[model samples]
Target: MSMLVFFFVPAVIFLTVVAPIWLILHYWTRSRQNKGLSDEERQTLEDALSVAERLEKRVATLETILDAEHPNWRTAREDDYRRGGS
Candidate 1:
């Protein structure tokens, strides 16, 4: 029984205290070592940026077309706003 106590107490302390602390520190350091955007996240961000650029170009083209078709379009809009015409 004395022999059992000698080994069992330390084993219990190691399992209940030291093991959890070691595991927490191991994972904490591992996560800190690999802190950057993953490949999939980077790809998604790039795709979104490209789509935004395309949409911006489309809007500029449509605005140019509208300006060519209606030279006084902006003044007409202001007059309509003053008269409360929708």
Candidate 2:
């Protein structure tokens, strides 16, 4: 009871006043200081996006091939290799 009594006022003060001010200041500073992507970073990001797009196209092509080769390949979750016959 005494411990609770000692902590209650400080906790209330922190929750009501300190935490809100801290959060506001933190976010405000972050927003103010946002130096968006540098030239190198931007170029790297573009390259990465291009690579990702190419990979996606390749995957689609592979899937298309698999689909044509075996129409039921998508539905077949084969566990034939399992020791206890699944």
User: Which residue pairs show collisions in model 2?
Assistant: none
Worst 10 residues of 1 by lDDT: 32-41
TM-score for model 1?
Answer: 0.59
TM-score of each: 0.59, 0.52
Alpha carbon lDDT at 81, candidate 2:
36
On lDDT, the leading prediction is: 1
True-structure RMSD, every candidate: 3.6, 9.8
Task: Give the alpha-carbon lDDT of every model.
Answer: 0.96, 0.89
Q: What value does the lDDT take at residue 85 in candidate 2?
A: 42
Clash totals for all models, in order?
A: 0, 0
- For residues 1-86, could you state the per-residue lDDT of candidate 2 as single tens digits? 99998999899999999999999999999988776887899999999999999999999999999999988776564544354444
